[model samples]
Target: MTFQYIAQRFERSGSGSDSFKALFKSAFDLMKEDTANASLYFLIAVAAKSYVRTYEDQAVTEEVAERAKTILCGYNTRVLEALAAEPAARYAIGSGIAYDYEWQVADF
Candidate 1:
């Protein structure tokens, strides 16, 4: 699923009550589907991190943040493994120069 679709799902999943938990559950459920696209996990990680950051001004218990971090780390490791198994390729821009591209896992 696309990031926008994930965002819509998050909105419908009642994120306000327990934002981090809801995000974690959503990501966990999606991961259980066993989608082969690594980008979906990356998007989920981005969405979860972005949602969690929105609570910076509020009182986010350390335990909640740590729990979410742990789950996210596991998902990231899977993404890295998926990327490693894919072949390296090149992409051509509008200028016609083909540049080599590789997927790099970003730490949250």
Candidate 2:
């Protein structure tokens, strides 16, 4: 499925960036709710590609990748759900990656 492919490519299993954490913060701020780290879903999406820069001309600096939070939410809502539903996916909900996730999006 599209979700599986996208997840594999973007999960960055062994790789964690300060940018990823920034995306988490931004998405949380944009969504304005903390029930779940759903924000991380959007964060991963925007961080995947430089082409998504600023995502609306908002600003795409590594320091402010949160701006793309607005753009990623619409597309990655389901991806978040899939990861969250996984027992091993606690990190997707803001727990931090405890294991590698397969992100096979190379076809993109």
- Backbone clash total, candidate 1: 0
The TM-scores of all predictions, comma-separated, are 0.37, 0.26
Predicted candidate 2 versus true structure: per-residue lDDT over 1-108, tens digit per residue: 234444444343322334344444444454444434444544453444433332434434543443333233333544456455865454444333212122422211
Please give the range of 10 consecutive residues that has the lowest summed lDDT in model 1. Answer: 90-99
For candidate 1, write residues 1-108 as lDDT tens digits: 443344445445432426555655566566656455434454545546554566645775666556545544444443444444533321112011111111322222
The candidate scoring highest on lDDT is: 1
Q: Give the C-alpha miss distance for residue 87 in model 1, angstroms.
A: 7.5
- Which lDDT values do the candidates have, in the order given? 0.45, 0.40
Give the winner by TM-score. 1
